[model samples]
Target chain A: GAGVSQSPSNKVTEKGKDVELRCDPISGHTALYWYRQSLGQGLEFLIYFQGNSAPDKSGLPSDRFSAERTGGSVSTLTIQRTQQEDSAVYLCASSPRASSGSNEQFFGPGTRLTVL
Target chain B: SQQGEEDPQALSIQEGENATMNCSYKTSINNLQWYRQNSGRGLVHLILIRSNEREKHSGRLRVTLDTSKKSSSLLITASRAADTASYFCARRYSGAGSYQLTFGKGTKLSVIP
Candidate 1:
């Protein structure tokens, strides 16, 4: 019954530092996704994980952005050598897996990261 | 990088009024979805309409899709102050390996009480 949850609601880090955002998907959800929202970029997709299949990282802006889902439940998005441009709200979402195309994702509160 | 664009970047309306936002996309899509974000936080799913369907409704929310013009519109009738938020339209293309979603810049709506 619980929705997706994100940790470290707010994170402030200096340039070149590294930060990791965590996401806990809803129970029985097999599809997870990560996105970033900023004034300049609006909202953009970052990564996607479905079942035990390989994660989709094509949306990641750069090599510094990476994510992994362990046990197909919890996911962590890591940004290395953070830059000021990385400042944005990181959001996570999860949806049930079905072929009918009616799976609507439920989102988390998100983690706001400010890179100085 | 973005598939669609929303008109009237910002809008203000009195409570009980209707708010309509339009989204125009560049390419074909399997489905289109509307989401609402409050205070720039995580988004809440509102509704989804397939490309084949002309219109769909959920409570006070009405979504219309025009595949011929590659556009969609979301209308919230009898809006309340609680509906103040940023609304986005997302497009999911017709492909398996392409799991990415193309989102519009969004329309900021303020419902005044």
Candidate 2:
């Protein structure tokens, strides 16, 4: 009965550093997604993983953003060489059904990343 | 690029009063979903209306979709103070390989008790 969970509710790091944000999806959920929200930018999709297939990274802003879902359960989003503009709330979500249906995603408490 | 716009940007209403939010998208979609965010944290899905569905209701929430106009409306009847939060509308593009949901800028609703 647990919902999606994320680690490090808040993170503060200097520019040029790297940070990793973790996400634990609900049990039996095969779809996982990462998104970030910042002032003026709204919510931007980062990456998505479905089942064992390839992950969709189209929405990733740059090469610095990367995510991997292991065993189709947990996912980690890593931001390399974090820039000041990367400061935002990183959110994770999971859907019970993988794809091809009316997917309603359940979100987790986001990790607020601040680059100074 | 299928992102939409939510009207009013911000709205304040007294408890027990009805609240309405409008959204407009830029592309064909399979379905549209509404979500509520508290303290800018996780988004709690409110409801989903498919392209084929003209309207749907859940509890005090009523959602209507107009695929022809690529717009939708979410109306909350008898809103409560607890309903004060940021609401967003996300749409799932209609086609394969497009599983991502496009989100709007969101509408901030303040329910004054």
Candidate 3:
């Protein structure tokens, strides 16, 4: 009964650098999501994957941001040429499904990305 | 654009006292969920209230939704000091064959013992 897990707990990189954050969703969880949280702010949805359907990329802030959920179990969020404003905590969450009946998402310990 | 906005950005109350947080959203939603976060880490799901339901309760937490007003409220009874954390209200809407949640700024609750 492991929960969702994320890698790199903390990452510090220079501006214009690229970083890849990883997430491992709970077993059997078919819905995965990525979000960014700025200091003292709310979570900003980034992307979402459900089963084998096309991923929702409407929330990605810019073209530099991209994510892929391989094998429908693990997801990777990639931010290219990171900007100072991109510095924030990246969170991952997963749920049993995307249905309204089971939409409660379990979150993972986020990776704190600092673009200096 | 953020869909939900929470009121009273911060709140302070004594232990054992009740606390209330409110959220207002711009669009119609399928459900509203509340989450608690500590130290800016992962958020823990607190409760979820559907648009059809007026009110729901779990333990000391009570959530109420008013689809007509596009608003909801979360109340915690007999709160303890451990309840201090950031409480966020996320609006769940269905679109593009998926359900996604948009979160508000959140309310920072400080329960003083």
Candidate 4:
């Protein structure tokens, strides 16, 4: 079986534009997570989706950052009116279950977004 | 355990030498894990240690967890140039916000060949 996969390996956009990153979690995975990494901010959690439970948006830096996991498999992270600070590598990961981090997560290659 | 930053944010070591990275978090956790990242891309999980466990070993990698001290350490024995990468420690908080792992700042290891 294939591991997690993300689309648009690289994206460069002008500031104030919108962008959407996609992720395809492994089949049967019940938990999905999104994280961002930047030189200034380090690693920051963005959002999480578990089974049918309401997705946890606590880690989202701002309302401009939003994500959706449709059919409990594919996920999309949308940044509205992106800022320069939004330039970073966006990573996606998935787990077999929502074991509260007890289960190991498989990560995707990531989508590198550069906002100019 | 404190979840702020990893000690010696950057380290350079000889290929044959060993490398140790430490992480401390202030919050209670159910488990801890270490991951390796190359080129600042996706992370590869190295190991995981549960709260009830004290130590874990995988090949040349050894992990120690001290719940009482709220700290964890990752030791790579007899490192190689290929071992060069940024290592991060992510802890699973016990209660609220346990859905996601809180990652540390990470230690960048440069193994000199």
**Candidate topping TM-score:** 2
Residue pairs that clash (backbone atoms under 3 angstroms), model 2: none
Model 1: clashing residue pairs? none
For residues A30-104, what per-residue lDDT tens digits would candidate 1 score against the true structure? 999999999634578888899999888888999999999999999999999999999999999998872348657
The fnat of each candidate, in order, is: 0.60, 0.82, 0.90, 0.65
Q: Model 3: per-residue lDDT, tens digit, A20-99?
A: 99999999999999999999999999999999999999989999999999999999999999999999999999999988
Give the per-residue Cα lDDT of candidate 4 at A110: 93
Candidate 4, which segments miss by more than 4 Å at Cα?
A: B1-4
Give the per-residue lDDT digits (tens) of candidate 3, residues B1-113.
54799988999999999999999988777889999999999999999998889999999999999988989999999999999999999988655443888899999999999
When candidate 4 is compared with the true two-chain complex, its DockQ is 0.68
In Å, residue A100's CA in model 3 sits off its true spot by 4.4
How far does residue B90 in candidate 3 sit from its true spot (Å)? 0.8
Q: How is the predicted docking of candidate 4 categorized under the CAPRI scheme?
A: medium
- Name the best candidate (by DockQ): 3
lDDT of 4 by residue, A1-116 (tens): 99999999999999999999999999999999999999733478889999999999988999999999898899999999999989999999999997744678889999999999
Query: Ranking under lDDT, best-scoring first?
Result: 3, 2, 4, 1
Between candidates 1 and 2, the TM-score winner: 2
On residues A12-116, what C-alpha lDDT tens digit does candidate 2 reach at each position? Answer: 999999999999999998989999999644689888899998998988999998999889898999999999999999999999775657789999999999999
Weakest ten-residue segment in model 4 chain A by summed lDDT: A37-46
lDDT (Cα, tens digit) per residue for candidate 2, span B27-101: 788889999999899999999999899999999999999988889999999999999999999999888755778
Q: What is the TM-score of chain B alone in each candidate?
A: 0.95, 0.96, 0.95, 0.95
lDDT of each: 0.89, 0.91, 0.93, 0.89
